[model samples]
Target chain A: MIPASFDYIAVKTVPEAVAELAKHGDESKLLAGGHSLIPLMKLRLSTPSFVVDIGRVKDLNYIRRTDGHIAFGALTTHHDIEFSDLVKEQLPLLASAASQIGDPQVRNRGTMGGAAAHADPSGDYPTCLLTLDAEFDVVGPNGRRVIKASDFFVGTFTSALQPDEVLTEIRVPAPPAGTRGTYLKFSRRSQDWAIVAVAAQATVKDRKFQEIRIGLTSMGGTPLRASAVEAALRGKSADADTIRKAAEKAAEGTDPPQDLNGSPDYRRHLATVLTRRALEQLTAGR
Target chain B: MRHRVAMTINGTQYEHEVEPRTLLVYYIREQAGLTGTHIGCDTSSCGACTVEMDGHSVKSCTVFAVQADGAQITTIEGLAVGSQLHPLQQAFWDEHGLQCGYCTPGMIMAAKQLLERNPKPTEQEIRLGIEGNLCRCTGYQNIVKAIETAARTMAAQAGKEVKAPAAVS
Candidate 1:
């Protein structure tokens, strides 16, 4: 499959990339990792006239902690985060999820920010970001603004990012001292996208859940928070029966899309099953 | 849409004006005249087009040539010196890691990255490391055997190198 011809422009700075995007408008697409964008281009699903290569932008590929949050530069690849000691020790959910994404070659090129911005409902990073309570920093001609992960993802293959704005960084709140997190993805192959996924996080004190958060992927048009299940689990003790009962509501309020991967009913069932596993594992492991 | 690009491939510098949409696999094969890198699925799903870019293995079909401007690239053609095959290649040959030989180049490139990061990988680790490269022949048992053999040979060679340099100087 041959992609339509396009002008390629590489920029070293965020402002320069933003200017290029503004000049080309929607005809231009920012190239980072190129995992999601290039495949779409090859299939003619997306035909941007100009490709602004922001992959080389300086100081935009790092993972560090600041102000009680882990701020990852937008260019940080899945491989980097998966192997990062900071992510391994602190955000195990992120490390685990990044490690499971699309094999080694894909992880080497795929960026966490790129995946989040692509906003694929079945994608791995969006749900992780949603569960982690991430904030996206976007820069434009006017200035820079931070958009919360919940508000940034608007629909399938869409986000709140304007055509002229460049996503510069991602900020995620650090889990509490005793909190642990886990992600469960049920993709058919190691390199394939998830049919249904669950990301569970909690801090148990004396077996009682001090804080609980669960996010579901591929159950709808966007990665969604399992709010009903989360509400039911909050303040509850971490036990097999309690977790199973709470996970029953994991698919509430979600309209799962019917596709070749799974039926809506089947996806709902997966959500319930995976949520139970995720919660049980998170509580039992550490 | 032709864009000027310059880069080092296999320790040699090359410059050309290529279309912005030209995939890196095509650039290496057509523009640079290196046919060792094979193209299986142009959609980035197949790893037959894999190559090492600046020390990381990537699917070249997914990367536009212009996007790789100013970066150093290593395709399968650059893996050996003279008539000497890379350790992985020799190991693959000895271990019968293929039936059709279509995925060998990409598989070796992927295994090179794996060994570079982890010189002595276990069998399970080698299998996990090459998950990106798909061999249609379904001869994964032999491929894993070849990688494990290569890792052992490479480690021994590295040990000899460490000893030889110190002895000579």
Candidate 2:
């Protein structure tokens, strides 16, 4: 109820949405799902003169296969992704992550692109995207640009998206054959945000770790890679001791913030515990 | 500014001009005059304002009237047919699913959605389905039992009656 008076324009096409965003610039906000934006607007935390609703753009709500990746449209609801056969088959990690997002209602109305673009530090999708090395396909008045997942997130409630750009698609590479991935989240309740979450992916070859990627959420200003752990994991034997020692380094270089749910120390502890759990789950071979 | 919205509620179609910021809960209670969908927490935490919007249960207080402009909505009042209560409503009444009756409607609506998706959910699944809905009075024990009983009744009505545990005769 605290939302101020704003122009409401529901566009039918992606180009129409992009053009409207181009015209309005900083004064307008593109609304898809509105799970994140509307709540902020209701709190009077953000005020936009125009709200260009892109939720009705059906073309931007699809899951298709691309060259080596799954092309997910920006407006694809979390519910859709959670129940998508293609996503489940191609990227079960994403499907599992999607299933654990908020609750049923929030999942029904929240969008993957919206969460990724919003880049909230504690959101679940950013961690998964970071581990998957996802690419965001953004469209603006100029054209389209594919931004790497690591570069897409800048800071709290911020992204690399330009002011006039609309995130059109999210392309997540299907994990390589024999690669395993898992997302581990710790929260007090089903609906609460993750206090700490970890997305760990690795490929094993000849009983040694061939490649490894680790993504952490709610541990820093942005979804971050466990670079120290990733470095320590390479060339190590796929054994419990090695993985545990590597995961212990998961909290390294992460200046986790303290909040009511947990202190920085607790979150750091959670990162270590969850990273170990995630790595153990992944090495268990799906 | 007020915009005209057309929607179907409980099998009746109505059109009205409403303020853009008017929440669906307000439009339902004030304009359509259906007060069964109670607004407990306007911040989208408590599902006491839960209603079926286009076949999906959503917290009405969190949704704008304009967002549901052309949708179909079903409230607690719509759950009964003539003089017969919905099986879930009857089960809740029979199983003591209410203490003050404030959270009953939302709990029933959310349980309906769960049963629709999964007709025979386990107790754990039922708990997960209604996690967004909070009921401080019932301690959640009787509420879960009521939902379980309703699911059985609904299944029986659908000709999928589950056999009760057999005695060691």
Candidate 3:
């Protein structure tokens, strides 16, 4: 399988990439890791006249600690996040989800910014980012702007990013002290996308839920927060019974797509079960 | 439009004028004359096209030739020194790791990365390490044993213990 012929533009810096995007507009597509866009191009699902290869922009491939958040360069590969000590210590949920995406070969090339920009409903990073309330730093012809996670994902396979904008960095606010998090993905196969997954990060104090945030994957057109579940569990006992009761509301407002992998009802059931397991893992031994 | 791409493959540098859409696997096989990297699934699901791109295993079928402009790639052909086989090749042969031998090159390449990161991996680790590479033959029993055998051989060659090398950036 080969993609349609297109002129390739290699950019060495973020300014150069932004300039190319401004020049080509919608006719061009920024190629970061090439893991997402290339596959679509091969299938003829996407045929861009120009491919702006940002892989040469080596500076946009870092993981750094900022003022109140950890900033990740848009080109930071999944493999780098999976193994980064800072990510493991600061945001273990992102690290855990990155480790389970596709496979080792895929992880080596897939980037967090690319995945978030692709905005697949089943993508691991979206759900984790939603739970973390990560902010995206985008550079465009008009200059730089930050988009909150809630506003970034518009729909399945869509994001709020304009065609002339490039996602430069992802800023994830550091979790509160003593906060523990876990990502539970239920897939038919190891490398397959999640059928239904859950991301939970919580802080428990005195055997009570201090703060908890839950995100569900493959439960809607876009990655969604399990608001009903979170509302039910806030300030509640961190016990198995309370978790089970709260988990029942996991799919309260979600409209999951029904496919061969599972029916909507089946997905709702999975959401409930996986939410319970994820919260239990987060609040274990509390 | 055609683009000029140059890279080091198996210790030899080759330059070619390839289309922007040409996959790295096709460039390696047709341009570089190295057919060891197989293409089982072109959609990047199968790791049969796996190759070492700058010291990391990547699906060659999914990587565009233009993306590997200045990379140092190591394919299955680059494994051995002279006529002697790499430890992984010898172990696979001894353990009967392959039946049809179609996925052998890719399996060995993927395992090369596995052992590079973790010299002594448990059986479960080996299975998870090669999760991207698929093998419909041998039931994966002997394949696990082959990786185990290769780890021990490489460890003994590097004195009593093998130290993980720094990853190439």
For each candidate, what TM-score against the reference? 0.96, 0.94, 0.98
Model 1 misses residue B148 by how many Å? Answer: 0.8
Q: Output the better candidate (1/2) by DockQ.
A: 1
How many backbone clashes can be found in candidate 3?
0
Model 2 DockQ vs. reference: 0.27
Model 1 chain A: weakest 10-residue lDDT segment is A277-286
Q: Where does model 2 sit among the CAPRI classes?
A: acceptable
**In model 2, how large is the Cα lDDT of residue B167?**
15
Model 2: chain A TM-score against the true structure: 0.96
Better of 1 and 3 by lDDT: 3
Candidate 1: give the clashing pairs. Answer: none
State candidate 1's TM-score: 0.96
Instruction: List candidate 2 stretches off by more than 4 Å.
Output: B161-169
The best candidate in terms of DockQ: 3
TM-score of chain B of each: 0.92, 0.93, 0.96
Over A122-165, each residue of candidate 3 has an lDDT whose tens digit, in order, gives 99999999889999999988889999999999999999999989
